[model samples]
Target: MNLAGLIFVLVTHFLAGRGVMAMFGIKENKRKTLALSMIIGVVLFHFLPVVLEVCHIAITATSISIAIGILTLALFLPVSYKLDYSVLKITRPSFTLYEALFATLLILMVIPSVWLCYYFPVFARDVLSGPEPLAEYAVREHTLINSALSVDLTSTNNHLKPPFILGLQVIYKLLVHPFGELWLSIMVCSFLLMFYTLIRERVHALIVLFIMMLFIMMPEIYGYMYIVLSDYPNMVLFFLAFYYLGKYLETKQANTFYFATFLFCLASSIRSETVVLIGLIVPLLLFSFIKDRIKPGVIALRLGILLVIPYLLYYVWMNVFVANYMHIQFNTGEQLSVTSDSVNIFFDRIGIILGPMLFSEHARELFGYIFNIFLFTLALDLVLWRKKIGLQARVMLYGIVVVLVGLPLLGAIIPWFDINNTTKRGVFKLFPLAAFYMANSPTLLQLSQAIKRFEFPELTAQKNAAPVMAQQQKIKKKK
Candidate 1:
């Protein structure tokens, strides 16, 4: 392992990401800021490899270092004029007993995954056919358009996909490990931290712990943490886009909204189909604008940013980048269907998903009661104990519908989006949305408040007394 190079990547990525946050004037609490900085840094660095390829620069260590130096300087130098030197100090926050236990458990769970990821060889067939080999030869040949493109492997069309995974792989293989998958670990850890920050403020620590455990234990989703696939990272970016968008609605922070749209663009670049998903979100965005009394021109411009950026990114990859590199012709139009049979196919796939895939024993093994729990809680909310669902929860529910319906809709339109393969992996996107809903559920919130009261009786008493005390003050004034 290239220890020095690995450290270089980690340090520079964090600083660069911090620089980005500062430049945009987007500040969160320190913990969240750190986590977001790391994620943003890693993703921004991945683009460096792609830029090198586009410029026909050699993908060597020297070239990578130079590009990174430039990028880091570009992002960091402007912000250097007013550096918060406090960022250098690492003060430890006091964790409650519940928080400590959960943090330790999460770390233990993640340690092995990281070790296994680094120790094992790349074995996923889809990866081998596309990103892995493409990355491997890119490292060996010092170019993205390498000898691998000359070979004919008719079994997979992954080669025709975007360079999101392949670019990161090339950078990691050049700078970190020969396997080039440690980048995924960084993404996973950073995302877990960001995810923790998301609901921690809304619920008690115990409830936060429970939700985090539930998310991490989803067998299929957990496996993707170590496995190098675009789906997992795609899921992270997609969820965060909506997450930050929700925050923007609540806070009306313009910078936060811009960041959310930027994340949506990044998600689309990871998977072209994500563009369709972003389009599905437009109605919700329009509803939000109309409700907010936003002007027609502002709504149109914001909508344009949401729709146009992702589409341009998709177009660039499929038309400009791939066309420039490969001779293969792609007929995406042929992939679409608009017949009665298409509607029938969509319903049939939905049935299979709702039936055998969701309720079967094998489904239990893959998802492990997570979805069942979500459905039960949602049913309770709808029927027996409906609490007023908040806007955040409603947005999450919308996201769940988008993924569940969107995947089959894609399958119906494109025959190759099979249930057993493409759609199955795509379901990974639903886990985060479901978990978010569970976090915001009235039952869970009530339980969380109970836990808080139990854990801090004095604090609860003070909270209870505050209203009565205010009432007493008003009575005295009237008398």
Candidate 2:
């Protein structure tokens, strides 16, 4: 792997959660936490030679790439698990085989049913393609995707935010065969997992499994799932973290909370910006430990210490060790990126930040901005049951608003719109949380369909209230 890629992986995967978690509630220390995260990145990445040499082995292109991913989970899971037990955090079973069955259908088949309504042409295009369309892009004898647009093996894009998709690429590289059958098989499973996590139903899972299947069936997203890219992987990882966090909230399972936090942090590395979302989980854990008054009947402080200790150690290590090892740079501007445009527009800059809103039909533009805000607020309300959820939400929303607001500022500051591949390609990464904000039941299924039909519900709760009961709609709305 390229040196930059290695560094990207370590900093992004290993330390992102710890970095973001450390900044919770502490305005003054955020930079320090970020600094520490960069440091930790150095320790993990820079130490590769030492680790490889100590084992008397040479790291392969695949092995090293694989190691970065495996190590992240290995490090996160055990410690997060211990933290749960030590904190005596609660636990509840979110799924049995049966519930998961239906959830699976909802996520897999059902969701896709809704998705197919909108992306009909995209799906039709793929279906109408040659029998070997995927073959044209399949991994070749040289161990790379056949397409000209395929990512360069030598490119230093090392941060595998959602490495699962990348792993698929590697698999195809070795298979030396068409990915047509393999694609559908994986799609089936991915849809299953997708729906199972989202709806937790096996029977229903299949319904929505194909929901986004056709949406993602678009050549760009579909191709990358079998090709080499981080989008699908990031999507899956973010979904997993969110799923686990939801489980933790529902059952108060310390295990889920710890794992969720760990996975969320781990997600930061895979996709770089998951740190913003992970930022929310850590503080909620700390506060709930200190202030929630929930009792495990024993080991309350021990659990609190457990919850805080890993984060603290990770922080100290990041700041003192990794940062020093790599001499990582920090940026405060990253935070203000969102609303920079709004503020700029507020100052009457040439370009509009809130687009047409800040002027013209000023109230309407603000309302448009507020429409997203309301979407976010509604989704937040529905999913914001757990304190950790709120914590994650705050961090995610912080970055989301930054982009929503910042692009205008960046546009104003720059002579022209920022159009680098990184800026354009990474636009989605910045809005990971925003995905959650918009995933209401109606929005996910019916409203999306309605949009295809050119309509929206006057009353939202009526449309998108999965996992949320009808009677409790008012409570969630009020919440």
Q: In each prediction, how many residue pairs overlap at the backbone (N, C-alpha, C within less than 3 A)?
A: 0, 60
lDDT of 1: 0.85
Best by lDDT: 1
TM-score of each: 0.95, 0.40
Once fitted onto the true fold, the runs of candidate 1 whose alpha carbons sit more than 4 angstroms away are 82-88, 384-387, 473-479
RMSD (CA, angstroms), candidate 2: 15.1
Model 2 regions lying over 4 Å from their true place: 1-56, 60-192, 200-220, 280-291, 294-420, 427-479
User: What is the per-residue lDDT of model 1 for residues 188-213, given as tens digits with 9 covering 90 to 100?
Assistant: 99999989988898888888888888
Best by TM-score: 1
lDDT of 2 at 138: 29
lDDT of each model, Cα atoms only? 0.85, 0.39
